[model samples]
Target: MNHEDAEMELTADSIITQRVIARPRPHRPVQAGGKVGAVPDAPLFLHLDAVTTILDSLAREEPVEAGGLLVGHSCTDSSGPYLLITQAIPATLARGERLCLTFTHEAWNQMLDRKQKEYSEELIVGWYHTHPGLGVFLSGRDLFIHQHFFTDAMQVALVIDPADFTWGLFYWQNDELVAANGYYIYGRSDQTYQALAELLTEYGVSWGIQTEEVDYNA
Candidate 1:
């Protein structure tokens, strides 16, 4: 059946599912980077501690692997190498089920409904899911679903590999998946720092942000 028919079916059901109506409200001004201010790329900065905390909480040996939507505003100007708006932690869910084609339609609708009630029409920044064992990257099917739903937009795909306490974020560009260079956000120790540094050097900009030591083992 088509998406329209699927919606009709869902509306008739009795389950209490959140509806994807619209973002509840416009994001209050934030200070990140993205084209919202004409910068070539959106500046994204994620707190490593925040990421670790979220992953830890979601993987506490509970059966319902945690998942949720990211909420934030767009940014334009910044002193650093990248621009970023900001995001807030609103609500979270213990994903009732794993993401797959079978559940994609329902999940999308539910997510949209939640957005409508919470953030108003803002786009999905990314999604987070706990990998009980699945590791930190999109499965082939997940990639296909992402392309189907988020074509031509800069949406983030975040996966948390709980066993190793590591995470992965994928940035989409022109239908091809590319590694999001984290040097601008995480500094030198980040795996992608050197790659981003090279890009900066080619652009005649200095990648002189003082590199901080990251004790991944900490």
Candidate 2:
């Protein structure tokens, strides 16, 4: 599978674009429950180390925002869930300058040209951006742009709020807009790890019950 180089309808000049490679859609809905563990098998576990690495790269450049492509493996086992196996942080662009989100057209054409040459086939799966003074949630303009251009539900959208150190995930389901159910992950702190783990555990219990969990991890 390959994508062509097309102009991205950026919502802001400071927008940073990232991508992740995903398997073709799963045959099943994965799970029908509403929370993380609700459909435990549907939950994705991102490597804390990998996530940390991406953040560190961004931190190294400070004021300027960074973006890149995410590559990972997927399965449907107990370990069947999606995991952020690895990541590729591209060069950084100035915070207030907008640029079209493209992988050289040549890169996108080959799907995994560069990575494949390195013996990997990870493709574009999602995007992430920093919200400096802006909040962590997706703005109206952000939603509109994402939906209009990238309509894939498996496509992940992340917003990082540097000021408050908060982060969020978003995914689209047909016409219904939805966000990931989990605690925020950011910076060098592991304070939210325990909460996130507990939340996922409860979500697993709720999954068996065919309902959404009331609790949320911070």
Candidate 3:
């Protein structure tokens, strides 16, 4: 189906439920130099509002790296397990440099408090950060953070380059990290999805669903 059609279906069925399933353990061997090998079967779905929020936060922190934790729930459809990211909670106490970000203990405490108070039903599905002009790829430090904190297989890391609007998502698979070539953004209204598509297209990124099976060794 096309993007419009897919959005329509998702909007018609917007009730997202949380499911408790055994976390997929990392088993894929890490390649040399910590480079990601291939795209995993898991997919990520973001609400249109969540995307807008992330972009706005990134724009506000221009020239320096900015990041935040993602809030959402996981569910299994006929297609398989996927994440539905509904919120983007910016790191209020994060220290950001040109190439790195350090989330303080206060940041973690605040995030946990907010999750308990406001988003008790959602999980910290992943995180996102901007790279300024550095391009879209996970650094060694980024890999370390993901491995230690977000160890769950479904947890993902999103890297966005505000200068060029390029972005990528990385997830754990077979003990290795895999970059997602494509993802989905579900909206409750047609205008929302249209705006999202336009935004991604204007930034030179493909917003449509990926059709080709990811070749891991490529």
Candidate 4:
């Protein structure tokens, strides 16, 4: 089978369940230059539970980098297509260092096996990795991985700097990956997002910044 066909087969076999949560509206104001607003076609919605799980795993990794695959359900609404991340599966078998992480073939197979056996209802929506001291930006290797593995337009890349307590999401637009200006954090209460914002701000990493365009060619 071809690449697209292979992806479809993989997804069909792994994704066995779909959960639809309440659609979350953007709470933040739009930034100037139209760089930081919800995309009409595909907006990313991150679940608070997923964020907490990822943060916990990052904490466990400490100074070293950690990586994981995002598993969730993709849904659409009147606004457009949106992905709701419900789970974060840590790559425990990954080879990690202070500056880099490589997900081994064994890890990939194991994750796929678990997805098929346990999380048959969830799909691999994207990926996330800690940057440690580095800021929230995708490196050349990251771009390559996104292009090859996470080729879906709705797929996103999340970069978090545990040292700085900063994070950003990268999405595909106009055939290029660009930093998302805004995203929704849905949970039982708005206070969840408020507390997270406050914590990031206390760490000197404000989340309210304009979406900066990225140049993968650089």
Q: Could you estimate the TM-score for every candidate? A: 0.51, 0.52, 0.71, 0.71
Identify the superior model by lDDT, candidate 2 or candidate 3. 3
**Please, what is the whole-model Cα lDDT of each candidate in the order they appear?**
0.43, 0.43, 0.64, 0.65
Task: Select the stronger candidate by TM-score from 2 and 3.
Answer: 3
> Per-residue lDDT for 32-67 in model 1, tens only?
122222222334554333343354456455444455
RMSD (Å) of each candidate, 1 decimal:
12.0, 10.5, 12.2, 7.5
Candidate number achieving the greatest lDDT relative to the actual structure: 4
Q: 93-143 in candidate 4: lDDT tens per residue? A: 776777777777666666677666766677788889988898888988788
Whole-structure CA lDDT of model 3: 0.64
- Model 2: lDDT equals 0.43
Query: What lDDT is reached at residue 64 by model 4?
Result: 78
Where is model 3 poorest over a 10-residue stretch in terms of lDDT? 25-34
How would you encode candidate 3's per-residue C-alpha lDDT over 35-71 as one tens digit per residue? 2333434557667567777877775635988888887
Q: Which stretches of model 3 miss by more than 4 angstroms?
A: 1-18, 21-41, 189-196, 199-218
Model 1, global lDDT: 0.43
**Candidate 1 vs candidate 4: which has greater lDDT?**
4
